[model samples]
Target: MQVAARGPAALTSGRQRPCRPACAGLWPAPTGLSARCRATAEVEADSAVAGWEEREERGTRFVAGPAFYRPESCAGRDLAVLAAALQRKRTGRLRVLDVMAASGMRGARYLLQADADEVWCNDLAPDAAMHSTMTYNLCTAAAAHAEAANAAPGTDPAAANSHASNASTNGGSSDHSAGSSAAGGGPVAADGPAGAEGAAARRQAAAAWEARARVVRLEGLTRDVCEWDFPPLPPASPDPEAGVKAETIASSGTLGAQPSDEGAGTSQPTSSSPGASAEGRTEERPGPEGSAQAGPGPGSSAGDAAAPVRRVRITHADANRLLTNCFMREDYYDLVDVDSFGSETQFLPAAIDAVRFGGLLYLTSTDGFTSSGKRPERALAAYGCYPRATPWANEQGLRMLIGAAVREAAARGVVLRPVFSLYSYHGPVFRVMLRATSSAEWESRHYGFLGHCFVHGDNYTLGWRSLAGAVCRCDSRGKLRKSEEEPQQAPADASASAVEGSAATEPEPSASPDEVKAPGPSGAPTPTSTPAPTPLVVAGPMWTGPLHDAAELRAMAAEAERRGWTGTGLPKSAEPGGNRAKSSRNSRPLQELLQLLIEEADPRLAPGFISVDDSLSRRLARPPPRDALIEALREEGFAAARCHLESRAIRTNACMEDVLTVAEQRLGIKRRR
Candidate 1:
């Protein structure tokens, strides 16, 4: 509050209290500051409201359904991730069955994002399944809500009745039936009979024992939580006074049609990390603030559930059997993921069989493929696979060792076309991406490892070759000498020709600095020795896993050993001296490398360093020696430079018996339920 003040000019003129002289560029507004402040506030409010409206419209379109209820069953973004991947592949209207659909979040999200012909969410846990069912029901209810909102104030009675009836038919009950009916069609038909029969049998058994065997199937419009016993929605509520008003706003018009975030203010910081330059350089710049909001918690909202689906199924089953059956029946899948929890040595054949002749299969694991320790043939004998040595480089050797299975598939007329392959972030998991198009393209991609390098490109290296004539027969342009072969010529020319041929055929010896003739001080050229060609080790195709038969395994084993292409239990240094010297020369910190592998493969295998205990058993179970640890990691197929430090230290710890206590979890290996 202020009293009425005198004019600034009057004060400055010394008519009242002596005020300091006004500063340059300072001017009072004719209407006063209060009005300006009010105007600014109003404008800000308008902008905020407009932004929110825009977000609401976009979000409404992107996220479908009544997801406010059953957030747990509705949330978890895995479905979105899967859906996005499928969309990129241009797959649509998939028939999906989430066998172990925990709360059905993944399936629900798929429905929201992709146009799925059918989605069947099944879970052994009744409560979780019912909660998921509620999510589906709410989605239908929301559609009805929209329709009711749009109805005119006064409409014809018959028209209204017919509309209502149609809505009822299109409601919850109809949705489920439609899903089931749609699922009954499509590629899913193959698995449906087996799955549905099993489910029905189980249901029958439960009904036989229980006195009350009532099954409550809800309509799409109204959720029957009481009958199904679904989980309750979150208890927290939004602020009533601060609720958002529903109003249309202008779109931000992003190219990808991404929704605008209304709650985010202009002052908020952006969420994306600074992008790297083409050459990987970073350009730093300050950004805005308060842009990102905390995402909804996992298992929280059904809005994520509507979308189309692609065809691919993952299950805990023996790959050998699964693939054989599918193959025998001429049933093929576009792709198969064989990263089981344990050893997949016996399942290679199944993978090959299940995948179409030209389909693709992704195999990952942390055992035989990593090192030479497990004889490729012997390790895969249980399933029947083999490998052939063509040629390979040192680094290429490591990569091939982990990707042995993919290579083996190629050997069996399953063309191993790599689309994308990458080393696992956590451990020795080797991810090999291969495409198998129907039968015609089923051939192995030949990879050669020789000298100190691995060549992945398509070309074979010819072993050391000798030219007919060595010395000066032709110039650098590869010209042939015109000299004719004289049967009766003197031996001198012959000897000279032999020498030249030998010189050309044999690799030129590495020249010492002193041996090189320097150019004259003015402008003469210097003469340098021709460098010797680096030696190369050829590797053929390799079959390391059982391809549905024992005979195949035996063949693979014999071939792997004969060619020295087998995975060594541990990696042996190519250079002189043992593991320790190699570690230093390779710039591979043994401890760090091992640590990183274990963390990626299974961190829980070795938790943390513990003090040596007094127990006799503990004393006897000292950690493996450093050399042994190095050998172990190398055997597992980890790059020498990639193992982490903690793993190495733990391996040699006094109390270390084993690093991987959780042996039950190996990627691509089958595990028990």
Candidate 2:
């Protein structure tokens, strides 16, 4: 092993410095501390290990090496934990893969906080590759020290001191000063050890440091870091039956050979060892030939084996190719996170393929234009669904994205049930988590089309059925009578004539060329149904199923509440000041958003939403407040709740006419048209 020496300039004054306090063993300081102070401490401690600065956020310490790190992403990191927790009930060991791990922060946190058994942090950036390696070394060392300390409860002071002395000698001369300073206030005597108590403390510290160095050695022996470009995915198979086989074949071509260690490799530690500065130093020490590989040391408990391993293999390769290889190997991951820069559509297929049955798949899409209906053609081409320009575009966009993922997975005999979905207006991205399973029947039932009527602001979900001749109530033009099974309600205050006039104003239905015709007894074509003069624009072959699993969401909410994360800006009942006050008290807006989503989720509910303002825009009188509308619906024995999709929207089982009647009576609004 070859180690580099640190210059005097890197050392603090000649006075010895105490061992920086370890927050919970080798893990960085706990979260909630001042970020700046935590960062400074981390830098001071690991300066000898690498050149990059470091920062701690949400209890995870990340080095600001060559990769980009954003403090604002802390909330997203928290959501990742929540997602993992939701999946923990279904799996014993959670294997995670961060396809675009920039600083390895997310992956590291998963290991430390999310009960992950293993994490593969892969990044394409050259700087990230180097920094991730260093991060793994630093974290592993801390873990080893923590384990060693735990394993050895008590020892004779003299023996501990002797152990410390030997550790200091092997660690190189640089660590001597740090150890001595930690022992006492001033410089140590030339010959004798510091006072007995001080000597023992210093020795213990030195032993821990040396243990970290040994771990780095073991890691270097077993793992290899490689830099290789990810190859393009093989062309999609034209035959549905051959799709899986073709994908496997293509993956082999792209990643058949083990990657070579092209970039900076892990060098062996020097004789001077752990005491050497970590900065810009490269060591190359080959492992003993034909020696048995090392694993978690004696200190590791059986329980610790199930926890995330400290060692990691940092690979610099294309994210897509890496995912494809995982699929080809049948190496299914418990959790696969694909946080791409833009649209995640390109990676969704591979991600779905790589996740194990009953596992979780988390995806993020920043391409709002495509999913939000700003770029309809792109949305259709990418998601195989049409995105409508509506007041609830953000929510629609999220569903469209989810619908795309569902379709992609279903094509490969996989069924993905959405567990959680987020349209973070703040982050301006759509994030979703789904549970993967294999059930062709379930997939068929879960995917369908949504037909929306702009004229009456009504929508219907058509599951596994043709959309031909579908007409909204407003477009029936009195040809189709209202179903007798439909509940009838009297208008709150509108005159009978006013109600009749409102119904008459609807445009006449007309026949469309696409309508499917069934022959009558004589084989003559069935009547050509006329299309509504004001047509109901078909919005999707998109996911018309429920956007959330109600039971799962409720369970998640309970977990959040247990963790003291239940505060949402939403009102639980018709309470005043509660919303504003609770919102004010919420330190975690992301959690609040999640809670709000849970409170509003209903699997029986349909997809589209009604914007109270947009619906009553043509009315001459002022529109009813959102809360008032919800309150009125409930009073009338209808189930109504605030919609997470839009601020001014309410979701309810009540018909549009009933909602409007309630609004008119409650707010004194009158339709002008």
Candidate 3:
């Protein structure tokens, strides 16, 4: 009974269906429950979180209510998983901060699939706490169920649970474990187990149930849900004793005093409750010297001492203010993910501030209008760059967003390098992963402006100082034409002479007398001695750096391959029962897209791509195939590759003239005049 992935329409058709058996172990839908009971339970669960539907991806099940569930964002989630995996690979443990948690699906998946040690899922909505807690409960319960099933007849229940836990903790196949048993295709015989296996199973189930009950009790005791604003706390005053107290707390691993209940809504977990024994419950007390001491709360058998307690803290507060607080507190994270609805510019400063040097920041910007050049005024106002609406607008948008982030970090004396940049057409947003560091030697060399000539398909990038005399190769009328006089050969050191030679060799088919203009007071006239100034449209202060770190992308690709996430050689059990085909389809594109990005990621090259067709549409009767032009350019010893920015575009290290010459020769088309 596999449950396939369905769209929003199918989900809201008002038809009630029974929970599939395969999905039962991964969620709270028990096998013994009747169809009506299952439906009722699901409804009750949804009611707790404002009617959000439950969805599964990569074998992790999470609830996504109408308020935060966006189908178009599934690709973003995939990238998040990739980032989490990469971080987990680099660091042994993962601690994630999901600021706008919504249904907490992203955080839950990180915990379940990315091997996250702890996740602080935060959302401003009061019900967010309940939603995240419920998600956690479901996942833990599923793990417990798998543990009971996997236990051998004579195995100790605790030992079996430990073995089952390894599968999830190692970021292996928890979903497959559940599906094998719950889907009714496993080696375990459900009814024939009055023997040792049955007893072990019963013990396992009891332990699982107890764990779930304990979580519920803790929630009731602490009132995990709250509605609050997170404002930046004031800087701490210098205290000579503070350092001593902190050192004592670090050594002991415990808070000196019990958390207050005044604003927190409830008291701490009581010692007298059921399962409150030393092995099951934690206790806190102040040290005799009045310094904070942290250690295992009251719970302590020598065996339990080996197992460290993993703590997860959730707060209802403004994400921006929380980031600011973290910055002020000098608290840093290895990975900071900021997934916002609109522009992420407002939060970039604090986010950058909160990350440790060399840490990663995953940012999402859904403000297409500003980043895509649809509103240049707004783009300049927000990102401090003029985004041009070109055929490769998506690429420009992503670069503009990165440029803004780099500028923001630089102002605070931080250097950021983009490790990966993704522009999803479906979301119409730009997502980038950048690594941050502190460096006083950072200069503005990587920052510059782009000069483009639409008529001749010529473009130039100039540094801040060079921009003063930068000019487009086209004439004033926006056409490239040969000079009537023989151009005098200037000294080899003269750059202006080289520009003139390049332009004079190829001229426009038709020319107007008004095309030529005298040079301005800024510099000497063109080497061709044209009377008129060159026509150029400059756009920049944009990022002229590589959008991805080649080494990092290659590692990610390898990780994807190792996980069988590249849509090839996946185990039958690894597929998420109903949506296997869809999942495979999605993964294929991601793999190809990654390959394309890798090929185009050359930091030494410029940022924008050239549309071969668009450039030669008027000059030639028929434009040559993209591959033909790229091949020709490569043969000429120029670095050339198909660009991911546009379908018929290519990115190359060759100058505009070189590119045009290759295209003209490959297509057997003469340049117009």
Candidate 4:
């Protein structure tokens, strides 16, 4: 059968859901950077401390010693830095809270590279020695960063780091404050000023930037939460910033956990440094116990003028306890980064509340199985979405994550929208940058169910209120069967209009099943009284909105270009999937990746992509070049582009028939049938 000349006009026309969101963005449903530097990473046989290793990434050198650092994950870090830097540029005061700072590398970068006003790095590592190592690396790194914050943009960071190291060692005292930047960055106000960019700028320019970091001892807390005998985070001090500190563990703060088996019903006691002033609103952390300690907190001397005052704090506690303490203290951060190993669903509520309303949340997930449709149980347990395997499971992973955050925020009477969604295949990691808004303008339409038919090649979204009916056409076989042949069922309730008084806003194909004529022997639309019903696989309570916000992508690309972050992020010696043995001939620049992401944001393009090789190339005697085909599709008035999630795939408003016609006519490729 010859494919249809015109694809679904309604899908392409109407410019299809104009969410080219502006910078401030629109909630209509309601709502809502950095690092690309490639510095050769040289690993030190031994760091300053015994048995500790040092490594460099994106031009910043830090202690990689005995901590969880994945060199291949540098691309994600690069993105994180860019995002943090951009947030700082916009918000003026960038204070970051690293929930699980396994080596403090990310936190160090936040201070050194993103210009974070202060960073509180916390890890659950019970190793006192390893904890000391993280503190030292973070403080010294912060010291150098703070000193060079105002130095010419071209200042050599290594020189400043060397100077700070020499100064700290000259004192022969292991007190962390010798070259600390923590003393002068001002108090860690329980409630920080969110939009005081003008004031923050003046403060930054008037005095030297400071980098200070401290790691606390946590021996009482059990390494395993299943034990439950350990202490939980105490309740908040009604007004802690005013100087009345809350008791270390008052036992009143509730754990805002979801139905996750991560860990439960446990807590830990917080201690305060002896003889230190209350000027720094740090969470209570126990200090040294008569010189048996691994290291002491940053210098308590308020008069250290040479150190230029840094403000970073590191601790040994689970993410829940640490963030709960922050929430109790009202010590909200400009950005909260949660880079969990599996999924961050359990931490979403606490992390969301810890942000300073309108701040950023950089959340990550590495559990591909949850969204692979192989384990709908895990998906439901984690993000409340029942995911099933689809050709586009990767994109589903991202959407699943965003939908979780959006629901969490809305439930808390806050609003959240995605700034960007990223998926990398190394660990099959999924990360998203979300901007939280104090203004609540969430529409249920944005979050709903998704359905894909086994027979039909198309995907559809079901609205919250309009759930009963979905209508899908055709098959995934890439050819139209003859009208006289037995017909397959239409997709299950893909189009909500299957029932009366339905309010689903998703548009349908311009042509109806019962058109003026029946399909010829060649592939074409057929006349039928009613569409056939096909088996449908549905997954939802997930985000049904555009994958990305284009306005934000434009800004992020500009930020990446400005930072000269051009490397693909993985080491040139390593393949993108982190295998050094594999050839990396296909590695592209960071800008190229960003550009593809920007293109993927085209609102006219639909949700799932059509795999060229999987869906189309087999049908054509000779498949057309992907780029040329995309160009031709565009010329034919269809919105089409390269899909970033899957290579050799096309994301378009064009239906299967239209695509087949394009291959049959524009490119002069003969169909096999």
**Model 3, span 298-378: residue lDDT tens:** 111111211122223344557886677555434455467888878878888988876645456888888887766778888
**What would the TM-scores of all predictions be?**
0.30, 0.60, 0.62, 0.64
Candidate 1 per-residue lDDT, tens place, 262-346, comes to: 1111122323233322111001111111101211111111122322111111222234543453454333333355543234545
Off by over 4 Å in 3: 1-54, 128-307, 474-533, 567-588, 667-673
Backbone clashes counted, model 1: 106
- Kindly report which residue stretches of model 4 are placed more than 4 angstroms away from their true locations once superposed: 1-51, 149-309, 474-526, 529-531, 574-588
Estimate the TM-score for candidate 3. Answer: 0.62
Ordered from best to worst TM-score, the candidate numbers read 4, 3, 2, 1
* Tens digits of lDDT, candidate 2, 136-175: 4234323422232233423211111112222211110000
1 versus 3: better TM-score goes to: 3
Q: How far out, in Å, is residue 447 in model 3?
A: 2.2
- Model 1 poorest ten-residue lDDT run: 245-254
Q: What value does the lDDT take at residue 290 in candidate 4?
A: 14
lDDT of each: 0.26, 0.46, 0.48, 0.52
Clashes of 3: 15
Which has the higher lDDT value, candidate number 1 or candidate number 3? 3
Q: Estimate the overall C-alpha local distance difference test score of candidate 3.
A: 0.48
RMSD of 3: 15.0
Best by TM-score: 4
Model 4 lDDT tens row, 72-159: 6766777677767655444334568898888887876776556554577777775643454455456555555434433423343333
